[model samples]
Target: MTLCPSPQFAIPDTPCLVLDDGAPSLGESLHCARDWAAQLPRAKYLVLLCERRSHFILGFLAAQMNGMTVLLPPSRAPGAIREILDAYPDSACLVDDGPPPAAAVVRNCRDFHPIRSARQPASGEVSVPPEHVAAIVFTSGSTGRPRPNPKTWASLVHGARLAIRRFGFDSRHCIIATVPPQHMYGLETSVMLPLHSGARVHGGLPFYPEDIRLALERCPGRRVLVTTPIHLRACVSANLDWPAVERIISATAPLDKTLAAHAEDHFKAPVMEIYGCTEAGSLASRHTTQEDDWLLYDDFQMTVHGEHCRVTAAHLAEEVELADVIQLKTARRFELLGRHADHINLAGKRASLADLTARLTAIPGVVDGAFLEPASVNGATTRMAALVVAPGISEARILERLREQIDPVFLPRPLVKVASLPRNATGKLPRTELLELYERQVMRR
Candidate 1:
């Protein structure tokens, strides 16, 4: 499908982004994009390191208009940024704050002054080729090294349209996302949704519970919170009065049912979970509190072969093989068992590392935690271990609570206590970091 310049619901005066300074009209955004594109350095790719949503939106649109593919690093870590630049030597970095990263060329987005003209730019429709590479988003590297996945204009736009319909929200909704724009879920929901579906997004990347509430309160009408399970739990525990919210969309990591229930009750809004990865945008969604089966979005089909599953959609460049072990419930619905790599077999008792981690976090007083089965050494798997964040609770007490929930065979051999898990921006625990922490805390001692 050819790209549409703007959504039908958006007019020239419609707010594309809601910022603390002021909302930028759709027409104004177009004007800014044009101006920004003209000043950007000539490059095949532009690494978007913009923290502010407004800057990210402008930079992304400018790159698209200039035929320069946007490159979204897996994280804002220095190493992650350097790896992308090294891999794509023809790319330039567009940063919003501080010194621009080391690259062939660097463009500070803050330097681009917005047009002070009261006159709006002509919002003309521009068609983008279906096969045009729009972006390359990297995986979170939770399981291994981060890998780049290319997204075409057609695919990104199509995925956004599918989400718009699936969520049953329109331009009237204001999106306040806690996840950063670099992540796939953040890009698809916060960036792509507003640009393609006419919804207005909050410019700030609110993290703390109070900040999120303030951002939501600033919206004029219906509000949608696009966040992860970590943010949701924090909000639910904050016990602060929340503004009216139309819906809460969560992704990244698996959301616990109890947390979802608490969030729904606290915010008085339904909590929805999206199942997808970097390779594919959002594939399916389900109301976490009310449903166990995930309904696939339009035009997407899922097929199961043995223990593995593959997904195909009209907008996808090719079929994507999923890492999750999904149990097909119906033609267009499925249940997530766990990640294929998370399955464990010890003493003939099978368990999922994800499940174990979830159980660990569920224990009273436990703040954050993870279950890791370190890589085998000399053909022998290391005993399963755990890192927990329980302030007052001892490791033995945490283990006692865990034993009550899980089989004895699956209990952590040496439960290590810590302040927090090494979670990335998207609330994903990278295995490499977890292993390092484990070695430092348990093995060295």
Candidate 2:
């Protein structure tokens, strides 16, 4: 399979990125990438630590053009950075702004200004070979230690094309994403979608509801909100009037129907939920308000073998096993049961932690919550515990609502009320952090 269907340099004058200051044309981006690539040392691997979306895109393209593999770590924590560098001993860090992280050779994007090359830039398309490794995206480390997943240029391009077609995006659409560019979902939807398709991406990564609305206001064309369940829920719960958005795309975590419906009603747009993981870029998406099952991407096939399943596509290097437990409705559609790791069996009764968490968040006045099975000591099944953030509602009332939704045997014991749940940037509650919170807040008490 040939990797390059379209050339990055072909669309020179087209508007590619919309920033607060001004829009950068595709020509300018290519020139900037070329300038940056010229200064980079002859390293086989480069670690991208760019916080801004546009800069991240610039570095990504430059690395690709320079024939260097880009390493995208799950986070910029000192430990995470160290792990990535340790894994790729010949790697160097590329930064758009801020002080360079310790323990790696640093290349600042700002230092390399965009300049017109002596030779005229190629007006024609360039093709990246199918086997070339474009990037290495690290897992979220929610289950355990973050692991690296290498993606070929062909796979990235194929996935981007799938998203563009699935969402019906074109040059007329402008994307505003809340997730960071390093995350897989963010990389595909916010960065790759614009480059592969003709869509324009907003440069800023908006988090607060007001900021999100303001970003949308600044955009000139039809708008799309690329965000996660957490950010979408906050936007709806805030009740702030939203700007006109053509549609919304959600990923990073499972979006419940209630939240999806609320977002659709509040924004007056369809809420599309994407199902994927770090291992398989984005495989399927659904309009949550209309469909209960996910529609897989074209040319992708899945095989269910008991509790686990594997996915294969023309873009994928091999059949990749999924951590999710799914009910295969057809060859191209499936209902996500939950993560295999999230299922808990106690006293011969089965329940999914994801389902319980969704139920907890659905209760009125409950802002955010999570249900975790306390670590077992002495090989005994420990009862479930909960950490909830409901300032106005009493713990008794919260439990009453939970009792109505869940089995008494599965009701969380010692439900701890708190100010907020410890959610990461993408709105994921890491199990390690959850365990830490339980040990300090609940077990200590």
Candidate 3:
């Protein structure tokens, strides 16, 4: 489990990061990392709060060089930041382009500049031990309380290498990612992939479809758009003229086959979906339009016993239990049934919430929706409830359409039409938020 056979940055003097201002070479990035590392306070842990992708990578490398554990919060919410700080009292904060949250020790990355005099000692090949904790990425808290998953340098680098090979990426590819840098998908694809695979990443995190189009137009060479299903749906529905995209990568939520086919037809590129979690990183990927089963990455093994399955990889510290139920076709291929926690049985019938939601969003005139299990009152079982955002569509009309697709018992009883679902940056619905919405909107009535 060697971190790197030879200690060195991948490709220097190549365009590694494409920022709004200008593209930064790997050499310059290494120089900035050296300067940033010199200014970091002596702390065992540091909270990385960089909104920009380039700054996030710089901070990550600087922390790695300084031998400090980087704590990647699930979100920048005040409560989430406070929880991490409380968990690690000896931690400090690092900011690149914004004011630091209330903390005793904070370092601003904007203050650091590449120093020529400081280049001698720090310049040259950089390497870290296989066991060094590169980062502690927290889960999305979609199911329960957010849990921290520590990733080692060896694991992170190994995963990056696998991604590079899986995607067939080379120095000619430029990535324009819409997801936030804090999320695991964004961190691995937009951050680590470029560092390890010799590809360049766009610095801007564009959300609007027009902005994404403009960002892609600005990038040169073969381009790859790393985004989620929500963003892809919006982009495809908008029907805006797009540049030549070599490929599109989607994750963080299940991608509908219809949408995937539409995106491929519209963009003239294939849509590759990555299946993974915060605990195991990226384990497998598939082309939604071409395959029903996912192909596992090299050096990874999947073992299933009864209803539970575990994944083991060279980069992983141990075998990780998968949250989703899978139908294993072979050692390297499987079809995802659904999340183990998302399956529910009522009235002697079984259904998956994910499947229901997918069908809900597929209906005409339905923008977004979710199926939730409302809290029971006085030990009385309750039927599934729905929160939807469909303007100018009647609840009866939506239900009429749903009746054709799902069984009567699985259909949502009270389909509460709302403005939108409370989705995080990565387009994942938190269970707590869904419960709150149900209690506020449906329960009262």
Predictions in order: lDDT: 0.86, 0.83, 0.85
Question: lDDT by residue for model 1 over 34-128, one digit each (tens)?
Answer: 88999999999999989888899889988988988999998777877888888999988888867865544887875897644476764734456
- Supply candidate 2's per-residue lDDT for 348: 77
Cα lDDT of model 3 overall?
A: 0.85
In model 2, where do residues sit more than 4 Å from their true spots?
1-4, 7-10, 114-127, 377-380
- For 224-250, candidate 2 gives per-residue lDDT tens digits of 999998999889978988889999999
Candidate 1, residue 342: the lDDT equals 90
Model 3, 1-445: lDDT tens per residue?
Answer: 3322332324665677887767776667777787789888899998998877777888888888888999989877778898999999999898775676655478876787732332233232467777999899999988888999999988888888888888888778999999987888888998878887668888778898999999999888999999999999999999999999999999999999999999999999999999999999888999999999999989899999888999998888999999999989998999998998788887778899999999888888999999988856565445888999999799999999999999999889889999888898889887887788878886468
Q: In model 3, where is the ten-residue run with the lowest total lDDT?
A: 115-124
Candidate 2 clashes: the total is: 0
Clashing pairs in model 3, backbone N/Cα/C closer than 3 A: none
Candidate 1 TM-score over all chains jointly: 0.96
Any idea what lDDT model 2 has?
A: 0.83
- Ordered from best to worst TM-score, the candidate numbers read 1, 3, 2
Which 10-residue window in model 2 sums to the lowest lDDT?
1-10
Q: What's the TM for model 3?
A: 0.94
